[model samples]
Target chain A: MMCGDEYRESLRRLKPEVYYLGEKIESVADHPAFIPHVNSVALTYDLARAPEFEELLTTKSHLTGEKINFFTHVHHSCHDLVRKVKSLRALGQQTGSCFARCVGHDALNAIYSVTYDLGKKNGTEYHQRLVNLLKEVQAKDLFLSGAMTDPKGDRSLSPSQQKDPDQHVHIVARKQDGIVVRGAKAHITGAVNAHGHLVMPTTSLKEADQDFAVCCYVPIDTPGVIHIFGRQTNDDRKCSGCLIDQGNPEYGIVGGEALIVFEDVFVPWEHVFMCGEYDFAFDLVERFATAHRQNYGGCKTGLADVLTGATYALAEVQGTVGASHVRDKLVEMVHLAETLYCCSIACSCQGYALPAGNFMADPLLANVTKLNVTRHVYELARLAQDIAGGMLATMPSESDWKNTSVGKYVDKYLKGVADVPAETRMRLLRLIEGMTCGTALVESMHGAGSPQAQKIMLMRRANWEHKKRLAQKLSGTGESRHD
Target chain B: MPGQKRRVSLKYCGSCNPLIDLSRIGQVLPAAISQETDLLFVSAEETNIDTIIILCGCPRACGNKETIRARALRCIVVAGESVDAVPVAEKDISTAIIKKLKPK
Candidate 1:
C-alpha cells in the first residue's frame, strides 16, 4: 500500500484542472489551500501502513483476496462494516478533520450492491462493469471523490422540469461505444485532489427525468472536467502565514469541497454503471446515504475526542479545570459524542447482507446516527465555546503574538495560570475556534445530507402501522371502527 | 489423570463504546476457567487454541468475524450481557463463559 508521501507524489503526477480564489491552481499537491486536505487524505494512506493502524485501516479485498486499504474494500460482513466505522474514527482522531475518502468509499459499496440487483432484474452487465472498476480501484489504491449533488438550478422543480437542463448531469447522447454527459456537481468533497470521481444521480428520477439518471466514472484530469474549490471559514488564514491562527493547519476543517462542471464529458460504456435505469435511482441514493450516514458518529466522535482534549487542556491552562461547571460541561460533551458513537456502532452491528452478498448498515439506525450528529455536534461545539469563554472568539492573531514590541504585552496580558506559556492557551483556543466555528459547524449539519434528509429517511423507515397497532392493543382499542 | 488443559485464546473488538466492563471480565476469566475445566487462557496469536472467546462491549460483537473465529476450533462470543447470544448478567459473564468451555 502507498504511504502518505507516495499518495502526495501520486497527486503531483496528475494535473487536474482546479481553480481556487478566482485563480487557476497550477498544482493541487503543492498549493497551500489544498495541502491540508491533501495531508488529510494522505493520512488515510499512511495509517494503512502503520503497524498500529494496519489492522484497522487495511483489509483483504473481497474480490481479489489481496491486501487492500479498508477504504476500497467492499464490506463482506458486519465485521467489515464495524471496522469501517472504527477506521473512520481512527482517522478523525489523527486529523481532527474530514479525510475526504469515505465519500467515494460509500459510493463504491452502494453501487456494488445496487448494480448487482439491477443486473439481475434488468439483464444488464452493470455489475460486472462495476467489479472491473472496483478491481482497478483496489489495485491502484486510488482516491475517488463521490460526485452526487448537482447544481440543481431550481429547488422546486425536478431535473427534467428545471429551466436549465444542464443543472443536473444528464445523458445528452448515447453512442455505441460511450455516452456524453453535461451539467455540474456542486460541493463535491475531495474533488480537487482525487484521482477520479464516481458520479451518481443526486435524487430519485421519474421516466421524464430518465436523461438525468446517470452514473459513471470520470478521471479528475479528464477532458472537459473542471473543478472550482469552495471557500471555508477562515480559509484565508492558511495563506496568512500564521500557524497558530489557522487551527489544525496540517489538516484544515472539513473535507476540501469543489464544484465540478462536466462539460459534455464522455464516458466509455465500461465506466458507466447506470444510465436510463430511472427506477434504481432511489435505491442508489438511499444506499449511498445509508453508507455515508453511518460514518458521522464514528469520525465525529474521534473529532470530539480531539476537541474535548483541547478543551480540557485549555481549562487546565486557564486554571478552570477545578471548576465544577467546567467539569460538568466536559462530561456533557463526552455524553453527546458517545451517544452518537453508540448509534453508529448499533447500526453497524445490526447491518444485514444486501442481495449481492455485501453488507449495508441498518438504514433506519444509520439515518438516526447522522440526524443526531446534526444536533449533538453543534451542542458539543457550543459547550466547548461556552467553557472556552469570550477569549476563544477574541484571541489575538498569531502575528500579534510574534510582534517584537507588542508580543511581550500581548503574551503577558493573555497568560492564564502560572508557569504555562501564554502561547499554549492561545494555540488551544485557535484549535477550538477552527473546529467550532463557521465551516466546521456547517459541515456537521449538512455534510452527508442535511438534517431534513435524514428525517425523511427516518419517517419512511419507521413502521407507523406496527407502532399504531401496539398502541391500539395496549389501550384496548384494537377493535377499531373500520375493523 | 486429567486430560491436557484446553488452550483458550482471547480477543477483543475496538472498544468505541462498550456497555460492559471488558477489563474486569478479562481479569476474572482466568481464575474462573481453571476451576470448572482444564482451560488455560492465552493470547490470540498462540497456536493450538481449542476455543476463542471474543469480548465485544455491545451486542455488535464486532470481533466475532469469520477471520477471528477461524483462529480456533470453537468460538464463544460475549456481547455486553450476552454469551453466545444468550442473556447473562454482567456479573456472571465469566462464569457463563466457563460453563461453555466445560467438557460434557
Candidate 2:
C-alpha cells in the first residue's frame, strides 16, 4: 500500500474540478479549508505504517496473497469482520474524526460478495472484474467515496415517480462499449478528495425503476463530472485567521461531504458492475447499508472516547473538575461507549460467510449497534456539554482571544484557575461545541440509515412467530414447551 | 505562523471512573493554545515529544499516561472533581432515590 506521503503527493496528479463558495478549487491538496479533512484521511495511510497499528490496519489480500491495507482486504472469516471494527476504532481515536475510508471499506466488501451471486445468476464476469480493480486500489492505497444516497426530489415519490427523472442517478443511455449516467449523488463523503467513486443505488427498486438501478465505479475526474464541496460550520476559521477557531484544525469535522453531479458521464464496460439489475437493487442497498451500519459501533465509539475525555479534561481545566454528578455522568458516558463497542463486536463475531467468502456483519446486531449510536453518541455529546457548561456555547471566538487590544482583558476574565490558562479552558469548550452540535450531531442521527431504518431491520429479523409460540406454549395454548 | 513556538505533548488518563471528563482538555487545549504553541499527542510508544499535558477525569488518575515514551519539558497534570471515595464500579447506582429516614 502507498504510504502517507505518497498518498498526499498522489492527489497532485488528479485535477477534479471541485467548487467551494463561488470559485473552483485549483489544488485540493493545498487548499486550507480542505487540508484538515485531507490530513485526516492521510493519517489513515500514516497509521497503517506504524509498527503497533500494522496488525489491525494491514491484512493480506485474499485474491493476490499480497499484504494490503485493511481498508482493501476482503473479510475471509468472522474474525476478519471483527478485526475490521477494531481497526476502524483505532484510526477513529487516532484522528478524533472520521478517516473517510470506512464507507468505502464497507462498500467494497458489500459489492465484492454481491457480485458473486450476480455472476452465478447471470453468468457474468462481475466478480473477477471487481477483484482486479480492488487489487490495483490496494497496491495504490486509493481513497474511495461510496456514493449511495441520492437527492430524492420528493419524499413521498419513488425514483421513477420523481417529477425530475434526474433526481435519482440513473443510466441515461447505453452504448456499445459502455453506458452514460446522469444525476447527482448527495452528501457524498470524501468525494472532493478521493481516487474513485463507488456508486450504487440508494434504495430498493421496481421494474419501472430499472433505469434508476445503476451501479458502477467512476474516476472522480471523469468528463462532465462536477463536484460542489459542501459547506461546514466554522470552516472559514481554518483558512485566513487563527487556526484555533477551527474546532479541529487537524481533522476538520470528520470526512467533509460533497455533492457530486454525474452529468452524462460515461462508464466503460470494464468499470460497470451492475446495470438494469432492478430486481436485485434493493437487495444491493440492504447489503450495503447493513455492511456500513456496523461502522458506527467502532468509529463513533472511538469518537465517544474523545467526547468522554473532553468532558473530563475541560472539567479539570475549569476548576470544576470533581463533583458527584459529574462523576456519574462520566461513568454513564463510558458505559454507553463500551456498550456500543460490545454491539459492534457481537455483530461481527456472529457474522456468517457468503459464497464469495467475505463475511457480512450480522444484520440484526449491526442495526442494533447503529441505533444505539444514534442515541448514545448524542447523549455522549450532551453530557460533554453538560460538564463543560454553557461556556461551551458562549465562549469568545479565537479571534477575540487573539485581538491585541481586547486580548488581555478577555483573558483576565475567562481565566479558570491560577495554574490553567484561560485559553486552554475556552479552547476545550469550543472543541466540545464543534463535535456536539450542527452537522456532527445530525450526521449521527441520519448517517448509515437513521434510527427508523434500524427498527425496520430489527422487526424483520424478529422471530415473532417463534416468540409467540414460546409464550403460548407456556400458557398451554399451543405446542408443548419442550422442543 | 509564529516562529519557534513551544510545544506541548498531550496525554490522557483512561476513562474508567472519574469525577471529570478528561478527554475534553485534550480536545480543546490544542485550539486554546494554538496561537502561542503546538500540542502533540504522545502515544504510548512515542518518546521525547515535548512538555506533557496530563488530563485526568478524577483525582485518582488511574495510570494511563505513565507508559508514554515522550519526555516532556514539564508535565501539566490536571485532575478533576475530588470525591471522598472512588467507586470501584459505578457505585451508588440505585434505581430509586432513597430518602433519609425522618425521626418520628
Query: TM-score: which candidate is best?
Result: 1
Output the number of the DockQ-best candidate: 1
Across residues A1-483, which tens digit of lDDT does each residue of candidate 1 receive?
788899999998998888998999988989889999999999999878754456578888889999999889999899788888888887898899999999999999999999999999999999999999999999999999999999889889999999899999999999999999999999999999999999999998999999999999999999999999999999999988788899899999999999999998999999999999999999999999999999999999999999999999999999999999999999999999999999998999999999999999999999999999999999999999999999998888888889998999889989999899999999999999999999999999999999999999999999999998888888888856458
Worst 10 residues of 2 chain A by lDDT: A47-56
Model 1 segments more than 4 A misplaced: B1-104
lDDT of 2 by residue, A260-305 (tens): 9999999998888888888778767888888889888888888887
Candidate 1 lDDT score relative to the true structure: 0.91
Supply the TM-score of chain A against the true chain A for every candidate structure: 0.99, 0.97
Off by over 4 Å in 2: A479-483, B1-104
Clashing pairs in 1: none
Per-model TM-score, in order, reads 0.85, 0.82
